[model samples]
Target: MLESLTMVRHGESAGNAALAEAITAGAEESGPGLRDSDIPLSDLGRAQAGAVGKWLARQWDSVDAVLCSPYVRALETAEIALRAGRAPAVRVDERLRDREQGLLGGLTELGVQRRYPAEAAARELMGRFYYRPPGGEAWTDVALRLRTLLPELEGHVLVFAHDLVIVMVRYILDDLDESTILKIESNQLANASISRWERDHSGLRLLKYNDVGHLQ
Candidate 1:
């Protein structure tokens, strides 16, 4: 059985910053104009990752394993954190990648409605949890992959990944339903925030959720 699990969302990326700007400007494309997997961190994101590493150094004597998403932003975060904390090397896991947005990859909500009305309508009908974007994986699909990964992890493990992956982890571990998970997702996770669980008699129990105290 796993003793403990600590998950961290990657620090803010250039893509993150771009998306926010795009939303404000009402742009059709909300990403950094690069493939999602290739986007890098912003300056603040690097600082945040460093803070997470410092927090890790203060919290635990050592972590048994470190895993990270293969995406550049996540990889950079993991690298920065590991260097700061003197933690073990991270093993990149493709399974931990950000949710593939597919055809909807860079489109803002307005863009989605304007460009792909049918897809937007379909997504509304299916709901966010089950709505697989044309060529993208749904939230449930994310959970399925995490389910496979969770069982194999043992001891204290740290993961550096995306916000969606963090949410899916909580959904699977807590046995949460669609409504509860969606509610949780509504409060977007902060950049470089921490979520953790520790094993007890009953099994793993949540010790923290979306904790960003370290960043402050």
Candidate 2:
């Protein structure tokens, strides 16, 4: 059985900033132009990663294993945090990637409504948890992938990944329902936020959720 699991969301990326800007300005596309996996972290994102690393150093003596998503932003965050904390080498895991947006990849909510009304309507009917955009994976799909990965991990493990992945981890480990998980997701996880779980007599219990005290 796994002893402890700590998952960290990647620091904010340029794509994250662009998406917010597009939504705020009512633009159609976020306009990062690059593919999702290639987007890098922003300056503040790097600083956040460094802060998380320092906090990690102060919290625990060592993590048995470090795993990270292959996405550039996640990779960069893992690298920075590891260096700062003098942690072990990281292993890249594609299963830890962010939820694929597919046809909705670059579009803001307004863009989706204006450009793909049918899809927007379909999504509304299906709800966020079950809605799978054309060619994209739904929230359940992410949980499926994580299920395959969970049994493989052992001892104290640190994972650096995306927001959806972090939330899905909680959903699966906690046996949460769709509405509960959606409620948790609604509160946007902070850049470089940390969540931890520890194994006890019954099972793994959440110790922290989206803890960003170190960033402040």
Candidate 3:
């Protein structure tokens, strides 16, 4: 069983900022759409990653292994964080990549509403967990991937991935029901925030959830 796990969403990416802008604008204007794999980190993202690195440096003894997503944004965050802290090198894991957005790849929520209203309605009716956008993954698919990856982990490990990975890992680790998971995901997680779990005799216990105090 994994002894300890720490997960963090990648630093703010160009894609992340663009999506937020579209959400704020109600997706009226063309959003900054790009393939998930191509997104790069923003300036603030670099600073945020550096901040987390300092925090990680203080806890250097707590981490023995590090894993990261293959996406550009996530990979950059891991590189920057580890480099700043002078910590252990990280391994790339495709399974840690963001849930495929597919047809919903670049569009904001409002874009989904306007361009694919039927699909949007179906998603709301079926609920977010089961709603797989065309050519994309449902939450369950991501959950299965993490479940498989869990057994592969050992010792103190740190993960740098995406928002979905952070949330779904909890869903699997805690044995949460779909309804419960949805409730938690609705709040979402901020970019560069940290979430951690430690194992005890009973089971894994959440030590932190979406913590960004270091950035402050």
Candidate 4:
């Protein structure tokens, strides 16, 4: 079995909190545009991160390494988790950043749909995984970027990245179709939710997904 690697999403962000409001507003129908990448995490998100770190510490005697996205939310989550668990130093990588929302960035979902119905519909139908932002990347693009970061592989690596990045990575590992990519749960992961994987002769197999037992 390949050494176990733990992948987790950053703690709660303005996006996650706004999610309920966005959905309630029916932004999809009204066309509020999607938000951009700069949003930071909420206090709850930070606490969740600490909880995750505590959980990791209890579960593993030691974590060999840490890799994280350069984004503020992800970086903060990684840092908090490491500090809580006494984890190793974390290495920041742009390859692990969230999916580019493109022209849609900063707009509410309904706002965007109303403003650019065609674009919004296209993005929803085609999904962001394979769809490229006007100047941004497709889901495949993100995966390619992450591929460059993969080493021969190391021990107990903890990765903190965006939700879309997490989903696309699952596609790469599971060999799932881009069309069906969104069908799988976004795996946005609770503030500190964790997923584990192990590589074998065949490939990496997910041992767990969206585990937030630590928060409880």
TM-scores of all models? 0.97, 0.97, 0.94, 0.83
lDDT ranking, high to low: 2, 1, 3, 4
List CA RMSD, all candidates.
1.0, 1.0, 1.5, 3.4
Model 1, 1-216: lDDT tens per residue? Answer: 688999999999999999899999989888777889999999999999999988888755648889999999999998888785656678988899999999999998989999999999999999999999989999999999998999999888999999999999999999999999999999999999999999999999999999999998
Segments of candidate 3 deviating more than 4 angstroms? 28-33
Candidate 2 lDDT, 1-216, residue by residue in tens: 699999999998999999889988889999578999999999989999999888888755648889999999999998888785656779999999999999999999899999999999999999999999999999999999999999999989999999999999999999999999999999988899999999999999999999999999
Candidate 2 off by > 4 Å: none
Candidate 3 TM-score versus the reference: 0.94
Q: How many backbone clashes does candidate 4 have?
A: 19
Q: Assess the local accuracy of residue 20 in candidate 4 as a C-alpha lDDT between 0 and 100.
A: 64
The models' CA-based lDDT, in order, is 0.92, 0.92, 0.87, 0.73
Candidate 4 off by > 4 Å: 26-37, 59-62, 124-127, 186-189, 200-203
Better model by lDDT, 1 or 3? 1
lDDT of each residue in 144-179, candidate 4, tens digit only? 886776653477677888777777677777788855
Tell me the tens digit of each residue's lDDT in model 3 across 9-44: 999998778777777777643334556787889999
